[model samples]
Target: MAIDEVLADLKQKIDEKLPKGTTISSVEFEGPQLVMYTENPWSFADNGNIVRNLAKTLRTRIVVRPDPKVLVPPEESVNKIVETVPVDSAIANYHFDPDVGEVIIEAEKPGLVIGKHGETLREITKKIGWTPKVVRAPPISSRTVKNIREFMKTNHKERKEILKTVGRKIHRECTSKDQWVRVTSLGGCKEVGRSCFLLSTPESCVMIDCGVNVGSEEHMTPYLYVPEVSPFSKLDAVVITHAHLDHQGLLPLLYRYGFEGPVYCTPPTRDLMALLQLDYIDVASKEGGRPPYSSADVREVLKHSIVLDYEEVTDIAPDIKLTFHNAGHILGSAISHFHIGDGLHNVVFTGDFKYEKTRLFDPAVNKFPRVESVVMESTYGGVNALQPSLQDAEGHMQQVIKNTLQNKGIVLIPAFAVGRSQEVMIVLEDAIRKGLIDNVPVYLDGMIWEATAIHATYPEYLNNDLRKLIFQKGENPFLSECFRPVDSNELRQEIISKREPCVILATSGMMNAGPVMEYFKAFAEDERNTLVFVGYQADGTLGRRIQKGWKEIPLKTGKGTEMIHMNMNVEIIDGFSGHSDRRQLMEYIRKMKPRPERVFTEHGDERSCIDLATSIHKKNKMETRALTNLETIRLV
Candidate 1:
């Protein structure tokens, strides 16, 4: 069927289902959703089930919006909203988007803004004829989130058009009938960085991740020059599994290269991805290096983003239906599940998943409706790769901190801004509250503070224990008084000069750059001070070098290169890792529902990948392979 005819038929079906005398101004597609603009917005007030039943019949998501003519002016609507909502809601801001007829209401307490059973929201909508979308005002403000929201509001028209274009493309007819599925590893196959994969069927082509290898000077970007991914515009969509640089760092390059498709990710991932990309550019400029893509490219990527919640199934292309499941490695991290060609096959890609639970999130999801082929990460799949229990790890970390602090020395923990930083915060906060450690100042440098602010905005995405602590018990660990934000060189200098006992968390987890390098330089020669590694350090990174007992390190100085003697007490706590160890990786495969027929391992050292594949094949008696970069395999 033609596009126009299909839309007309859908409109007719909708019209027949709506109540009599109700008029729909127009029915339009808006990126995996059918938006129906109604002249009588109140028609849906008493008959909510009408739209629900229609969605069930159409087998697509439906959204109801007031017609442009029905919506009141922004000035008048703002007044109505202010008068209707309770004063105790502590509304922070109001943003009006006429393109979508939505008034975004940011408040300290969104529940109060929504009222009991959405009564206040309905009242505001009825008063102004604009839908009220309530969002929480993060306790700690995030500049990245603020900038993105403001940009979105200012460019509503352009964003709307982008969504419409994406919607039309997704709903277009598929002309191919030959059924086949293949996957190509453009990078991140017997290595841990620059992760990219191409999943292709006759009718659709999707890129799973486009990342960078921050540690390697020779190989920085994924193999976009490959014929399968060249001209980047041919990709139907790009799905990001997480916000780590190795997972989403190089995404803006696609926009720079003429790709105009939507990027799919969870809400937190979208925000964090923007933060890290912008930071990447800033770092490069400061370091006298050239950035591959500009900030304009990052904005383009954000404008074209379509955020999806966990388990919400959406059609990305004519032959592909995509769903996200929690990956437990980081906030907003997901395992991509693709249903292709009318259920001909299902593929699951576990992107940097942690099979065991952490303080920040639940364990990665293993159950799926159906999965015939699986692509998994083997970052910690070596034979001796077993981590201590979480309890032991926490106790060890606390004891180390105590010993350092009691001796009047600072503890420097080089952590990633996203997952490991936040995890350490929670652990430290709990320890302080329980009097397990002194209430010393915990300093947050680099992007750790900003990243935690983003975490505060999405408490629902956290683990159940943490969520309840935030929502029910009113104890948000991220907001503990012990934590301090270091925003200037003056404060950093003061902290180092004071010689006080404290714990400092700095970013650039691998110790390649960022504020952690400065702290490492300052504390490296102090035998009393301690350096902790709470996360993985990729090969070729400075952190990995230190892990391998490189005592004399050459670092750039103001005058010339200087060698720094590392005398600090260095500790590696394996249980704090976000990636699953060998045992957990095997357990994930063993517990996976409806066991897959074939498994491919990636995202690890060459030996680790090969070991994992060999172990899985021997233990489970299933076909397994460890893919190398640029290898292509046909599944069906």
Candidate 2:
């Protein structure tokens, strides 16, 4: 077909598939390539996947132009589609290098063309010609680790200066010279998880979210080994944002020290914490003595908890009012909003949030009259952490389970006692009811059964659609007949000993610590048994070691310690990650109305944190910082 015919055909095909309010403005031909430029390509953000899928169906390549000004090739066929995009007003600073057949586009805004893995360059090349290698005007010296380090120090110094200015403005309202308030992070300055902050005024001292680092065991102190002489204990309240271990794991240990204040969180957070702490205890017991804390201590911590509803703001102390908002990470998980002082200051702690909606939670709420400072989780700080769709995750999980059960082989699912375990059970139960699997016993050991009961009691905390399905439709996926809750240690041992082909779901998803170890020891030697991990496992943990395809595990059993040979199958389903990916995090930050003045990236690896900080500064022009453990930077 001629170029004009191709352009007309492409326009017609796109118009047919697209919903209302989209139209192609024109088409053009550049060299041998063809392009169909659209006037309204904002739909690409919402239906990009659909466009790509349609392209494949039509046996053509479709590239959504990121910029509207880029000229489009008109010769592209409707059926033999080349690419389409929005034309932006910006001019390309650098074009392709003809010597290497590389597309070297220079950028005034260098971040956009580089995207999350040079996606912008890839898109341009897919639509135009060869993959473009982006190059900018060279500096006097090449960019290196040394240069970047200097750049960061300079940036940090500048940020501190800016912060001092802001802090002075904030402190200007102090009525008394002796009584003043300043803000600073106790831990997690740059990264996401393990967010704890210290807010001090002459009349009040408050600490929020006593969290443990999930990334590394090299330095895993709950508060970076900060000594608690009296200042730490004098705090009015130690509030937890959610039940995720990174957020709530270390609260019990606070009671081990001299601190004896209320451990405040949601009611479901209380119940989930018990389940998590018990599992933590069980894991520590198997690994030998000196576990973090005992079940007794956890019980003590629970007694000190003051459960508050989402919108009901409760005064924890004379100077602090606390409220919980749906974080959308998991059931009962909350983004803590603190109204400090008498209309003095407000700070929000997003424990672990999901801004985008998911199968089990609502989107993160962003409504507050005042929010002076915000602490957020950065688990997906690295670009790679973004997730596939919920449907894809479920479908992938279904396939893994279905394949494992087909051979009548035992499928051992090592899941966290909290959210992941419950989700997997629901998926399995649905599959079984759908007659997708053979009649096989499905066992629920560890704290999962108890956790499910807690989940049942708190329907309002769950996603709106899920609650409606359970309450209105009367569908009991959690209480399915196939799910046999192992009530006692003896029952668990019996189920492990039984030679039945079944699906066993146990706690401590990482196998670092939980009942999963017992089952693993019993079945590790059997080739028919499959171990599936659905969450991130810390390094040096048993789960991480096993997932790396270790054939031998040194384990201490009831009889004694011994090195066990293993032939069990192992797999990791990565899409179920609750934390947002790097892409999602950036988008979330970009969308914040009246954007935050500063960004601290954390809850990720060193590389992830550094990369995230760079992105924040480059893309948003925000003063982003990444701090090491125990490092403190005064806001004033």
Candidate 3:
């Protein structure tokens, strides 16, 4: 049915189901939900089956809100909430969105605020006309979380309008019934950076991941200029798989252009990606050049964003239903599952998935209700991509640090701020506790510290062991006292000049930019100092070049490019990556609940993609193929 028809049908149903003497003022679509303004909102509280029957009949979520005039003042409601909710809940923030009649309550212990069986929430809703939406704030107070909340509160009116606009677009009627689906790779197919792909059918157009190629300074972005998603005028929706720069870095560019569709993602991903997007702009501005989009574009993206929890099925387009599964990579990272058409097709895109368990998170989810064609990342898919055992890798890491410390030289570990950095933190913390290495002050950069803070917010998403240590055991390795944050570059310089024997974990794991480069430039000439890599360094990157034994390389300086000698010891410990290696990759396919019919590989070097595809086809005989950018595949 068309959007107008759906709305009319819902209105008629509401009229038929509402109790006598109850009147509705208006009805509208708020994204995927149906919100109705009724004078008899009390009846909804009294009748349980009324809403149950309506929701089942409409096959869409519904919310019955009170008329505008019935709401109590915000200040009065705040006092009531404070008096009603227990102090143990530790309410972090509370505000009322007048436009939506929602009382947003953020607390450290959301369970306490919810009471037993959500009695507290219902009490608040019944007392005041405003609905209570209790959210569990991150255990660690994150500046990124604060910034997003403030933005929404400050521009509630604008955010409301944006949601209404998106709701209409999602419910738009389909114009065709062609039961064929195809995928077009815009970028990140044959190589690892600038990852993007267009999933299109006769009824809808969706992009799985839209990100830029930061390593390629030459082609440092995705092919957004193509006619299909160009100007992004015809795009229905965009689903983000993770918060890494390669997966969600170029999202603002969509808003900067003309794409006004909603970006579906998990809550943790929304916050983490916002943090990265803001940091990207800050880095670009510091380099004396403008980024592709401005802060306004980013704000627009946030306003248009609709967060869905893992396994919570949501409709993104007329024909596409989305479900997020835990992708054991980072906080809020998810494997994107799109159930398209009326069971006509199902596609599972493992966006940078890690099939094996890590200290930070559980392994990526392999079971699904249905999967026909699977798009998997092949970062470590080559024959030689086998990783050393975790025990061996940790031992080697400790030995490297031990050697550097014994030489009275500082050690620098370059890691991606999101996943690798946190994983290494656990390794280092555990080593120190076990007395595997001498105790040293482990320095953390701003990005690492902030990213760790984001991780602390949602402990439930982490691995079983880590989550137990955090929520149940009350012992978070990330909060270890030995860890010191390098708040500024001047502080970093001071630490180096002091020449103290310490370890530093910094960002841009590839040493592309950020605090990692600063530390690398300062320590590269020192033969005693060591640079350890615990993450993947893509091709065309400085880290890759150094790993390939580049004695010296030219780097951009304030005045001109200067050659930086690589005298410091550079070592790579292979098992600490968040992405699955060759062994884990094959095991993931082998253990899939219902194995996929066809597999396409991307997000790796050309050789890895081909090698992995060949192995899968030869072993499983699943009609696997290696894909490249701009390649199109039809699945019917």
Per-model TM against the reference: 0.98, 0.67, 0.95
lDDT of 1 by residue, 370-415 (tens): 9999999999988888999989999999999999988888899999
Where does the lowest 10-residue lDDT sum fall in candidate 3? 39-48
Model 1 global lDDT (CA atoms, 0 to 1): 0.92
Residue pairs in collision within model 3: 138-457
Candidate 1: residue 410 lDDT (0-100): 88
Order of models, best TM-score first:
1, 3, 2
lDDT of 2: 0.63
For 1-636, candidate 3 gives per-residue lDDT tens digits of 877788887798888977788778888888877888876565666565777798888777778888878888989888888888899889988888777778889998888888887778777777777878987687666899888888878988987887888788778888895788999998888788878999999988999888877777876787788787776968988899999878888998888778888898888899889888889889989988778888888898899888888898777888888999999988888988889888999999999988887888888999999999899999999999999887889899999999999999989998899989988999999999999888899999859988998888877788889877876777888888888988877888898788889999998888888888888888899999998989988877889999999988899999899899889998999999888999888888878878899999999889999999999988888889899787789987
Best by lDDT: 1
Ranking by lDDT: 1, 3, 2
